[model samples]
Target: MATKDADKKDTVLATAKERFEYALSRESENLERMKEDIRFAASSPDDPWQWDEATRKERKNNRPMLTINKLPQHIRQVTNDIRQNRPSIKYRPADDKADVETAEILMGLARHIEAHSDADVAYDTAADHQVTSGLGYIRVIADYISDESFDQDIYIKRVKNPFRVHMDPDIIDPAGSDAKWCFIDEDLKEDEFKAQYPDADPIDWQYASDAEWYPGDKQVRVVEYFEIVEKKTTLCLWANGETSFKDEERPESVMAVEKPLKERSVMKCECRWRKLNGQQILEGGDDGKVFPSRFIPVARVVGNEYEVDGKNYISGIVRNAKDSQRMYNIAQTAIVERVMQAPKSPWVAPAEAIEGYEKVWQTANTANHSFLPFNHKDEAGEPIPAPNRTAPATVETGLAQIAASASDDIKAETGQYDASLGQKSNETSGKAIMARQREGDNATYHYVDNLGRAVRHIGRIILDMIPAIYDTKRVARILGEDGEAANAILDPDHPEAFTEVRDENNEIKRIFNPNIGLYDVYTTTGPSYSTRRVEATEAMTAIAQGNPEMWQVAGDLMVKSMDWPGAEELAKRMRLMLPPQIQAEISKDEGGQPEQPQIPPEMQQRMMQVAEQMETMGNELQETKSDLQKAQQKAWQEEGKRIKAEIDADKANALLAIEKAQDSAAAANPAAGQGDVQEMVNQAVAMALANLMQQREPEPMPEPEPPMEMPQPEQPPMDGGMPMPESEVPQ
Candidate 1:
């Protein structure tokens, strides 16, 4: 049994070693092909054998080689553009209306990762290098270090090394790209190996310092490779009596029943590598397989779409410019600089007149002298004049035309024109400039799209590892609305009970949740994603200024997207300018139910107190009004009664006067008939009443109808006796 076990162990080790060897052998061929591509990208496409020092020395060309190498320039321009724009990794909830807290946590995590990792710098390096070399590579890896604090705490890093990484040749995605296999072979010193793996036999590996570039005498090559392996896992079932068994068959004899475990296939990473000293392996090797390498750590970014045939590799911008550049070189050297070989008019004089002519020729050809030595006299004694000749105009014109054509060819090939470069142009209108810019953008959009795709892939890799790496609680800061940093706890595993939600004013709401990691990753895109944010900002600013209300809605966005100096500060100040009451309204996000206004506790208390005080004041005022109204009503009633009494007295006096006037008239004029007396008395009484009415002030309402009536003057009763007694008249 022991011998068999040993054999099995040997077999596993042999298999791992064999796989490593096979991977190295296959990658070697791919590496050669990549070497040619790299050489071309580096702009050093000289066939080493054909153009050595020997050949150059033999070909004695007086003119300096004027190769206008424009490929690197074009590559740099596109790559620089991509770097300047720098797409941000944005996080959004998979479901648009998902919990805000969860989405915030994801955003906070992204912010944290962006801040902690050197991804920005790495991205620029990758983009520039990728464009130059047809392929760019970056690696994402999780690292852990232990000291006085936490143990096995993972942090992610973006490794941007395009030169040394070897990957499966057919793969073509650096952002979240996948590969069946990858190897990172770098030389390290003996001390590094010992420091990293203290438990290993450090002395077993041979050291060679001369062949490797590592900064140590004892150098070893560390070959680490990732391969996919399948792992068998058992799916266990825990029997629940209620669901798994009938009531009568419930387990009474045992506490629980264990069912047969089901088998499943799980894909895992068999990470194996060995340190080699020259041609021999070291004493220690990775014997176990690492689990679940869902993605290869190495990211491979290609210039164009994934090419099935290796021949379709995207070359640099100069590939087509080689001929143009050569043409330009000839135009410059043979035409532009041919003035040094200008023709001179030969003065045909007699031989006798020509003296010291050799010196004159030499002086004219070489030196800038004040005077030239020429013959003073000819055989005929007539003066011989030296004539000058003009260079052909066609040479200068040809040179200019060739240079211009070359310039046009470069612009056409690279999609970089005067308009795109912001050079002075004849475009008179903003629309025309915009049209030209769009044309340029369309031509170079592939490079930007490639970069965007890579960026998205990187976002995916970061997202995948977030849930695992940040399984515990973490406080991370995110750029909030109006460009302010807000804090959130990134604890994906914790239950919602531990969460503490706060409002804009930082007052905690009753509900809370620490939900983290449920999110999707995206790369910022569209015309807005490019590097022309300054232009956009200017245009937006003009529009916003014209429409102040538009600024109110989009000012912060303009500020954030401005990309100009002081943009962040400007945004913050703009937010501060808003009135406090409407600040929350402006800051309100459009997604989840708008958070209940975050009134401060002190303010809320003050408001409630003010409300109560106002209520008390209102009650007192109502009571006072009621009392005033009652008092006025009572005064009115007393005035009415006095008026009524006065009216009665007046009426009584008027009736008495009428009676006296009737009696006197009867006594004075004894012969007058009774009917005539009665009529005259009635007229006199009505006139007196009218005069009284005219003298009296109007009452608020008509006085109650007078109760007293005029007393009948002995009515000359049916008996017609001399007027009955006044008391017996009506009584």
Candidate 2:
């Protein structure tokens, strides 16, 4: 087992070394070009104007090699524009299982992650480097949120030095998102390496002496290498239409229902990372960690990528401008040298003319002298002209013209003109000025667009890792588009897998779930919130000025667009003063409750008087209703009493008749008993009372009429005491 382990380690180390060497060799030329581009762009003291050592040495003695760097100004113009309008990550639903709400939550979560990790710094740095050196890099990684927590959070980390990164040369994508392998190299001193990896043996500097960028006497190279590994796996399409890879860990419930409707053999790609050196796999060997995302975590931002003869070439704004800048520097230097070489007011005369005024003539150019006496005649007694001072030489127009042309060349190469650099140009109209500035923007837009692509890749990486990292039930911070921070409950095990949040109308306003759904990532670059607000304020102000009536209707909105302090409060107060109809329309648009329209004092008094009148009318109507009810109830009682009296009278008459009949019967049949006669009379009385009571049944009382609708009072005009104009009134 020990020998087998040793052999495995040896094989891994050999494979890593081979891969590293292949990448290094493939990207050597591109890397060297990128280094030169950076050196030119940086304009450091060591390489000012990127002059060659031979030329610099030749001019070291006396020649002026002035470096008038114009590249940085152009670079800054592009970079700062991007900063003002930063790009943001956005997510869209790509499948039936993914919903817009979930996409929104994911977007918010991504924004929160970006804010937490200071991803703006990373983004800006990458863009700056991309503009400077043709290439820049950012990477995503998972780390513990703190020392005490086992939970992990994803972060976008900036690669400050692009040269430290080496990518697969065969990558075809401009953003390098398709790269299958990458290496992030770092060098640590011997003691730091020992402290970081106490158990592992450091690479022997003597053994790997021939390696480039590695195994120095005082430093050791450690690489964080990422590669995509493929494995054959079975993908089960469940009966419910959901699919899962067999290699993934699933719950028992899912396993029980694992009767697959269809099965397929597929190759799955997984990204794995390792910390290794030339001699050994230091951190990740057989137990290396696999990234949650299939693509490598590193994101590359490239400017103006192209192919020449099947070989890839990447360039930045500085590449084409370098020559123009060098030319400008040389021309300016020549002009300075010419000016310095010119004599300073040298007197043109014979030596005998200043025979006794040597000191005076010597001090002529350096100091102010009262007078200088010179010989008017030569030794042969011939009259000689007085000494005259010669004028200094002027710089040649050709040299000045060359400098001007070189300056224009730099601007042309970089696509940055006077208008774009905040300099006044010949354009008289604002539109023409803006159009010229836009031209410059269009020329350099690729650099910013490439940064957006890289940022989109970063979003994908973060989205892919979110489910795996935030798998537990917890609350995560999220941000709205306005950068308002809020918390979202992430529950991966819930049956629905998302929490539905409803608005006032009981409609789902948001779905908070970061662990479920397949979403597509994108990036949008636009004016920031504050910038947009300022623009909105300007637009509203202009519109209001053009149509003064608009202020009466939408003054609150115009005020709200302002970014000054107390603007919101002032807007809120203004909203209350708006007409009720306008307020309602605005509220409907904003999905908020309409504020009550403010009423004038006179209007309030009128409303109170109308209310009082309605109350009085209602009281009188109620009293009338009560009186009618009482009268109806009394009439019913009297009718019932009369029916009762009629029933008694009928019973009495029937008893009399039955008594007479009984007497007659008893007389005819003397044998009839007296008790039987009395019983018959009693039956007659009962039958008579039942008939009378049935004939005199009382009618039920009718339901009272519904109360009359109270008349509505006329609404007072909302514009103080003045009536609203016809055009201003709501239709």
Point to the candidate with the largest lDDT: 2
Model 2: how large is the Cα RMSD against the reference? 6.1
Candidate 1 local lDDT, 1-731, one digit each (tens):
97986675556445545655665564564445455544544543243211235544653366333445555666777777776676666666664334656665555556556555666676777777566545566666665534664523223354455545656544544453656656566666778877876654433222323443334485556655565444444333234321222222433323545452333344433433334333333433334334223666555556643344553344445445555655655566557345645543233444543365666654554667676556665668877665333543345686878877987786887777778877768897999998998888788777677777777776766666665555565555565423356666555544442356667976653222333224677777543233366677888889988898876656776887776689879987766544444555654642233333334455455445555655666666668767767776788789889998989988898998799879877887889999988888898789878878888876675334333332322222221113334354232
**How does candidate 2 score on lDDT?**
0.81
TM-score of each prediction: 0.61, 0.82
Clashes of each: 5, 0
Model 2 lDDT tens row, 297-404: 999998877788887777888889888888888888889987986756588888899888898888877787788789999989998889997777788999989999
Computed on alpha carbons, the lDDT of every model, listed in order, comes to: 0.57, 0.81
Clashes counted in candidate 1 amount to 5
Show pairs that collide, candidate 2.
none
